[model samples]
Target: MSEDDEDFAGCRPLLFTIAYEILGSAADAEDVVQDSYLRWHAVRGKGIGHPRAYLVRTVTRQALNHLRAARRRREEYVGPWLPEPVRTAPDVSEDVVLAESVSMAMLLVLETLGPDERAVFVLREVFGYSHREVAGLVGRSEATVRQIAHRAREHVRARRKRFHHDPGTAREVVGRFLSAAGTGDVGTLMSLLAPGVVHVSDGGGLVSAARRPVAGRERVARFVAGVARRSAPGTRFDITSCNALPAVLFRVGDRIDQALVFEISGGLVHGMYAVGNPHKLGAAVTPRLLSRKGHETWKP
Candidate 1:
């Protein structure tokens, strides 16, 4: 590998993680990283004191710029806009804070923040960057960054609740949910869902899905089961990790038709996010990209 490539190898994942958190899109994150790489090449041999810092700051600025422009497109989104789900390994980030920051729930909360606040909060909180570093990265004064961080932290804290994850219980619930739907037992399915459980699907208008979120256990259960019944004859569902949590991947032949992620709280499924957008499924389904586990022993 070239010197620049080797230098960036270690920090590449971190850059993507930062960009993804800021922009909430894997595809866009990759673009930011790529753009940063080109900029790195252009500045080669410039006696850059810190390449990692330079690259991260460059990527953060790119993501912030991209997000500012993309907000309009999101405003015109055809349906309830959802973050593009990406595969994450348990060890994707050595820091627990960074690892957990990408959860769908957190992403949803991040969506509500302004682009600058999101950038400040992500750099300061998620990645553990200091107020000064965050300010330099986002091109704001330390005081301004602190203000944004405070506001962002307070906003997310108001919305984000700590839900302890129990993998065993989560896997069991998800597995049983699939089995219940497969058997067309709506009652059993409803029993596994919380009363306020919501089913949100994102097809990006490239495919068919519930444009608005489907709420209520009974309603979500029915919607899930109905979609199950509509699956192709040779389809398959396998338990896997989406955004570092238990999720289901629907495979029709070799290509993935949909990626479903569930949020388990209080021993019941509280939220369901189904990504049916074909454009976004490539990263969500690549076996090499994500970690997977089977739930053959799941009982309803």
Candidate 2:
């Protein structure tokens, strides 16, 4: 490999993560990173001081552009739209801030922000970039970037609920939910669910799922139990992490039918995002490596 290739390769994980956080889709993030690499290759000998920073700026711009275009597509999307779930290494959970940044709930909150605000927030809050650095990355004035950051922070903090369950609490709740769901135990399912529990399934118009969110503990419990009881023969469930949180993958043989990630607060399930879209499920076949620092293998 050429020196230029190696240099950009070294920054791929960070670049992919930045794009993923902004767009909430691994497929789109990979495309943006590849396009950035092509652009980076075009100006190899231009004496760029820091290839990492240069690639980051390029990827950020590309992702922002892609996001603006995607808004129209999402408008016409069928059923409830949820972010594509990506698998992460277990160590990612050790960093509470990093884990929350990629959580399904947080990603949904970020979806409400404008493109520029999302870019600024991800760069500044998630990646630890300063106002000046973020301004340079997003091509905004430092003062303007600060305002955008403040506004984004307030918006996020207002909508985001604190997830206070420890790993053991999460595991126990998930285990019980799975058992009750599999056995069609509606009463037990309701017991484990919060009073206002909500279940959202993203079918992407290609599969069968609820077109809107299912709310209330009883309704969600019945829905979950009904789905489980109707599962195809030989169906199985795999416990794993989706976006660095406990998740269950429903599978038939080797093919995954859906990926459900839970939101546990106070030892009760408050929310669940089930991604039944086949396209979104492919990215989680292998866990992607992520880091707050810019050094790790680019692809996993």
Candidate 3:
């Protein structure tokens, strides 16, 4: 392979990873990565000192630009908007980081921030970029980057508490949620949710869903029950780990219709994010477990 090919091979994964972290859409991230590769090849012979950093910076800037435009598009969106789904490898470390960084609940909270604030927070907190590095990537002063990150942290904390549950606890809670929803057991579902739980659904105008967040346990419970009643017969609910956090995916005749990703605070369910947009559903790539279960035709 040529030097350009070698660089693309080495940098593509990292670039995609950074883009996904910023944009929260795998499709968009892939596009950003492809675009970055084009730029890389265009300047192949250029002397770049830190190739990894250069790629990361490029991808981040591209994602940031996309996000700025996306925000405007969302202003006229028909319904709720959710982040795209992300499939994960069944690994411990990756899952843990993903649960916190890419969870639907977290992504929704991130939408409240400006593009620059979101970029700064992800680069500094999720990717562990140094303040100086983040400053360079965002073209801001180091102190400004720190300030943006600090403010973003506070904003997230005020909206939802950190999820500190062990993996086992998360699995257990998600299992109960799946069982409750599948059985249409409103009582059980209510029992598991925190007193002031919130449910946010993003149908992106392609499907019918609440236009705004439904807050409070009773409202959320009623909505879940209504969905259960309307579910097509023989629909199956599976407890899967999305982004390394416990989540539930609903399958209708082998096609994934919706995914529920959540936030757990102090062992209680604080928030539930329902992503039903067909566009967003494309992120539900076939899991390895499905292939081993003798299932075919499952695609994201």
Q: Per-residue lDDT of 1-300 in model 3, one digit per residue for the tens?
A: 986577567556556666776777877888898998888778756887666666677888999999888878888987777787665545623445544676666777888888998899888777777899999898899999889989988887787446666667777887877678767888888888899898988888887789899988778877888887888788877776665556778888868888887777667788888888878776665541110111112111
Best candidate, lDDT-wise?
A: 2
lDDT of 2: 0.89
lDDT of each: 0.82, 0.89, 0.74
- Residue range 1-300, candidate 1, lDDT tens digits: 986677676567777888888998888888998999999999978988777778878999999999999898999887878888887654543444654687788999999999999999888887778899888899999999888999999999999845556778888888888889999999999899989888999989988899999999889888988988888899988898778767899888889888998888778988889998887776685532221111222111
Per-model root-mean-square deviation over C-alphas: 7.0, 2.6, 6.6
Ranking according to lDDT, highest score first = 2, 1, 3
Clashing pairs for predicted structure model 1, backbone only: none
Quote each prediction's TM-score: 0.92, 0.95, 0.84
Clashes of each: 0, 0, 0
Better of 1 and 3 by lDDT: 1
Error of 1 at 188 (Å): 1.1
Better of 1 and 3 by TM-score: 1
